[model samples]
Each structure stands twice: as C-alpha cells, then as structure tokens.
Target: MTKLDITKTNRAIENLLETTENPRHRFMLQAYYRHRYLEIAGRYEEIFAPEMMVENPVYHFHALGLNVRLEGQDAIKNLYREWSETGECVMYADDEEVAVSDHMIASKLTGYQFKPGKVLAAVGIDVDDENAMYIYKASEEMVWPYDDRCRLVGEDVWEVDPDKAEIIKLDPADVITASDARTMLEPLIKPLPPYDEAAMRPRATAR
Candidate 1:
C-alpha cells in the first residue's frame, strides 16, 4: 500500500529479467510487461478483445477452492468484460523466469497472488510455437481467490468441490522450503534495514 511497495515491485521485475540472455525469453518478457501495463492503465480493450488475444486461450486455476479451468478467449474476455464495467484488476510478482527452447518458453514463477479487478495471474501456459502464449502468476505469498475470479456454483456462501477442495493460504510458512540447521540461520544473515550511519555516527570533536 505504501509508495515503496509500488516502486519495489517494478524494480523487482526488471532485476528478475536482468540475467536472461535468450532472445525468446527477452521478447516474451517485454511483451508481458507491455500487455500488463496496458491492462493496468485501463486499456483492457487493446489486450482482452478477440482480435488482440490469441485463439483458444486456456486459464487454469483453482476456483472456489476447486480446480476450475477456464478455456478460450471468451473465458478471459468475459471475465475482464464484467470487471471492466467496475474496475479491472492487476497483479505483480518477483523472481519470474522464462526458459526458452526452439519454440516454446516455460515460465517458473513464485510469489503468486492476485488482487481484485480482471488481472490473470498466469502460469504454465503455452499454445504451440505458432500461436500466442503468455502466463502470469501473482506472488503466492499474498494472492487469494476472495475476488471470486473463478465462477461460483451458487450465490451467497462459497461452495467447495469435494474432489478438489481447499481454502486460502496467506501465511508465509505455508510455502517455506524444507529447512535444515544450515538454512535455519538464514534470517540471521538477512540484510538489515537501510540506515543513515553518516548522520547517526558521533560527530568528530576537536581535541
């Protein structure tokens, strides 16, 4: 919510793609930013329309705590169309990667989470080399489905799919990697808060 988090997110994205040397990854990352910024800027028509979007786009995710896969441009367009009348959504993530091959690029993402609006936190998306494919994911650390991005079976309370039912996971511990003694001290070595030591240091006195 603070001004710092906004600037921090943009810088984080730039840093994430700084090391990628592949041409395909570079181009995709560029397009990713362009399309995303367009959405964030309220130009949803430019990217969500049938002509702008790829054919048969598939949006896969857990809906109302169930794995509900939304397919085709219609699914993505309709979702945005409805939200656009209200307020479209946007998402931001860090540590994003694009692994390139001869044709397709697979993205490895973390820190997924989504805010309200029509933003699609994409992931593991591909539609052949000749076709368009782009996947996004919010920081899993904070994103949730409360906005009801996925269609609910009924109104009022949320219903769970018995076969694939689950609830929100907002706690950091939920996604922590397996820990051992060596890694346990990570917090100890973590960088300290920024400081102004020059001002804090005692002024030299004439002696």
Candidate 2:
C-alpha cells in the first residue's frame, strides 16, 4: 500500500476546475478529479477488502426504506422481487447493517457528496443537476473485488472492474503522494484498526 498526498491532489483538482472552460471537458475533468478524490479517500480498498474472505454467503437488499439481509436461496429471490417491483437494486454490505436511507448511496460508495446545481464556482463547474449524473456515472465506473466471503461470488463484482476499480490503481501512479492518500483515506473509510495484530502480540506470561 502506498501513501498519498491528499493535500496536493485536492489543490490540483481545485486548480483544474478553476481554469477549465468547456462544460463537456469540465465534466470529464470533474469525474477524473472526483475519482481521484475518492481514491485519496480510500473508498475502493475498504469496499473491496481483498485481504479478507467470506465463507457463508448471504444476500441483502435495501428498498422501500427497509434493510434486509437474507440467507440461502431465498435471499436472491427476495432481492429480485424488490428490484422488479420497485426498480431499486442498490445494495451494500450485509454485515454492516447499513440502511440505504441513512447515508446517500453515492456518497457512501464514492466518498464524495454530489450536490447537483451547486457550483463550487471556484472550480468552474455548473455542478447543478449535473452533479447527480456525474456521481451516477462515476459509481458505474468504480469497481470492487470481493474475496471468498462475498455472497454473489460468481456474479459480476461491481467494485472490482478496471474501469470501476481505477481508484485502487491510483495508489501506484505516484508513490510518495499516493501513500499520503492511503494514510488519509484509511482513517475515514476504514477507521477500525486490524484486530489480528493486537490478537497476535505476545501477552505477558505469569512468572
């Protein structure tokens, strides 16, 4: 894992936004910037958790303002019904018990709030309703790789595709700067420290 220079990356993005003119170009730039932003924010690694593997598979869905994680074949059946009935298929980790409504899925998934129609102005983006589109598009591009633990192991892993997983790749683009981003994003996205280290440390033995 490399460190990232979040400060420099953020400033550069701001600078690019300030000078860019064309809306289409600006949109692409913003997508790239936001992608880097999420990368710096460590959204990719946490969501993927490549180091860990899941054993028993379970599927969960959030819709109609309800959150449910189901076990066995029935889980998929319920998820399909929900999607067919409501046209909502946004899913999150079943282990976390996170409610879809509690946090904006875009922000949760991407690590940046997409406020449409509001321009930083300083960044030169119209940012109005287009912000929604930006986020949706970016989310579509972001990918994650689930370990053995994922319930839908054989299916498409939205978070792991190259187009979708570009954020993770950002770590290797620039060594020193990337490390900084990793350091910063790790706390925000994966605040909890690894338990294995603590569990493995030698305990004081009684004399």
Candidate 3:
C-alpha cells in the first residue's frame, strides 16, 4: 500500500555525494546507503551484511507520546521485516538537511509515510474507507552513529512535530506494494564499490 520511486531517491543521493568532498563523510554515507535499496528489494540479509552494524545496535523512535526503542540486531531486523512486509517504510523525504562527522550522520527532513486507511484507524484516525490509501506527513530528524569501521552503531529518531502531523487520503489508484516498487526500483540502483580504507581516508591536503 506504500511505495517509492527508488530511481529518484538514488539520483538524489548521487547528487549529494557529488557535492560532498569529505572522504570520510562520503565513505560513511555510501557504506550505509545500500540498506534502503536492499530494504525496498526485500533483501534484509544484504542490509545487515555481517559487520554492517555493531553487536548491539539500537533504534530509538521518539514520536508523539511514545518512545520506542528496538535493541539488538534481532529486534532491529524484526522491525525492518515488519515494515517491509507491511509496506510501512515506503516513504520519502523533502527539505533534507544532512551532516556528517567522524562518528555520526545527522539528518533533518520532512518525512511522508504512506499507509492504508485501516492502519490509520487502528491508531485512532477516522477513515471513510479501510481500503483507501492515506499519507502521514511530519518533520523528522535522525542521528546515526557509526563505529570507526563505519559500521552503524545505532539510530536516534525524533519526530519533530507529531502533534502537527497531517493525514491526507489518496486516490485508490495510488496503491502500490513494496514488492512492486522494488521490482521497478532495482534497475535504477547503482551498487557502490566495496569498502576500501585507503580509498575512504581523507587526504593529507584535506586534513
């Protein structure tokens, strides 16, 4: 019931990469960027790709009156599995602001999540049709911390304005499954080169 044009998102990231000159920053972004593509493709195994994360990875989602934290790889994996299966993660962002450091990547954006009317109803939103599609929009920020190896350690997400979140119903024709999106988006995804410390190191001139 949710989808994204992966081609478009890929191009956006490529453009950002082109403008970013920091080797470490580019390295970290490139290292973790493939997860979303694999997620869309229903390839969760590749998303984790052994050593992609630390032994105990955590994800904290702070929204509205709720604070949810998923700890450990299993917990994180199960959540992603649920999102992929339910198509809840089929969303995009706008006005994105991203920053990188030796150990973290911070992002702020206006995020839009697509969901079925039924899902919204379960959350106490009144919907006229259970089968109808609806989109929820909110401003969000996420802090991603990685290890020296550039493996992700955890994520802290803040829903900046959940109280002001908006839900808009969409036409029935807008319905699209995550699997279908993956099929359409996979072709446009360009694989990043394998990690090479030598390649990722900041040059002496840059230092």
Candidate 4:
C-alpha cells in the first residue's frame, strides 16, 4: 500500500468536516475516518478478506448498549450482504438504514450507521436494536428462499391505473448469483490506497 501523507491527510479531512457537516454527524464521521485510516494502514487485504471481514466483529447496537453474540456475526454479515444489495434505505425517525432482508434478519434499527461522506461514507452499514425483527420472520424463508415478495411500486406518483400496471417480483437467489454478488461488492471491496490528490479532490459529488 502507498503511504499517505498523514499530517496532510488529517488536515484535509478536518477541513472537509468543518465545512460540510453538522455537529452530530462530526463524531460519526471522525470515527469513520479513523477506521477508514486503519483499513488504509492495513492496505485493506484483511478488510475485504472473507475469512477476516466479519471474523468476530463487534456488532454494536448504539441505542441498546449491547452487542451481538459470538456466533451472531455469521447471520448478521449475511443480512448485511443481502441488504447492501437490495434494501431500500430510508431515514426512519432518526435512523438512516433499515435493511429489509428477504428473511427480515433484524428490525427497528433505531439509529442505523452508514458510511460517512468521505472514505466511502466510511463504507460500513450497521444496524441497532435488530434482534426482534430477526425472530419475526418464518425460518423457512431464511433457508429456502421459498417466499418471494414485491417491492413498493409507483410510490411518488399521484395516481395509476391498476389494470395496466404490473410489478415484477425478483428472487434474491437468482439476482444475487455469483456474478451479481461480485458486481455489487466490487466497489466496496476495492483497495484503499492513499488518495491521489488531483484525482480525488472533492468536486461535484461534494456539492
């Protein structure tokens, strides 16, 4: 991995934060910055490694002051992967991410965590207060992909003729196949090299 100009990088991000974010989001962004820098320090081989990515990760529930059980990361990670691919993100109450896995892995993510504005929004998606929802879904849906459901259709429009419209239902198994999964994960798992100043200077996306 290429080494970053640490002092320069810190000053740059601090300036970015000062100008763009609110106080509440600052802490979240700083934490993301540190974690992102750590991954950068490690050159990201471990961060994206399947054997290491979720290996005993501490899944913290911000609202509950709790964490996932030892083996829980397996289910949680799977839920995360599926959610990243298909869940509709909503800013619920104060929560920002509520991933609706086909199996409903968790519920009531009251104050979810998404990536920050920088470093891929800190690129991690986590949920809080999630256990109750995992218990609500029938077990078979988790195992067999036996149930297929349609997403909300024609949400913003005022009126639609029901007779002419049809919603296409997708099967997660068919959609998240090997090729699709790679396509979805490629960007997230890309290497985190030091920023190339000219190439990465915040521009249109920031505004």
Which whole-number lDDT from 0 to 100 does residue 12 have in model 4? 36
Q: Measured by TM-score, how close is model 1 to the native structure?
A: 0.43
The segments of candidate 4 whose C-alpha lies over 4 angstroms from its true place after superposition are: 1-54, 62-73, 85-190, 194-207
> Model 2 over residues 41-119: C-alpha lDDT tens digits?
4333222232221333354433212255555444544544443232122121211111111111111232221112222
Best by lDDT: 3
Q: Report residue 40 deviation for candidate 1 (angstroms).
A: 2.7
The collision pairs in model 4 are 115-121, 116-121, 116-122
Better of 2 and 4 by lDDT: 2
After superposition, candidate 1 runs with Cα above 4 Å error: 1-12, 48-53, 63-66, 94-207
Question: lDDT by residue for model 3 over 1-207, one digit each (tens)?
Answer: 334444454444566788887777787777656765666666676667654678888889896346899899899889778877777757666677777777888888777777778878887877888777777788989899987767888889899867898887876567556777677667755565666676565444232
lDDT of each: 0.34, 0.31, 0.72, 0.27
Model 3: residues >4 Å from true position, as ranges?
1-6, 10-12, 198-207
User: What is candidate 1's CA lDDT for residue 148?
Assistant: 12
Model 4 scores worst on lDDT over the 10 consecutive residues at 137-146
**Which scores better on lDDT, 1 or 4?**
1
Clashes of each: 14, 22, 0, 3
Tens digits of per-residue lDDT, candidate 1, 1-207, equal: 211121223344355469866443344344444444444334445655332245455555443233566666667667655544333233334564444332232443342222221222232222232122112233231111111111111111122232332122223322212122113322222221232333222223112
At residue 25, candidate 3 shows an lDDT of 75
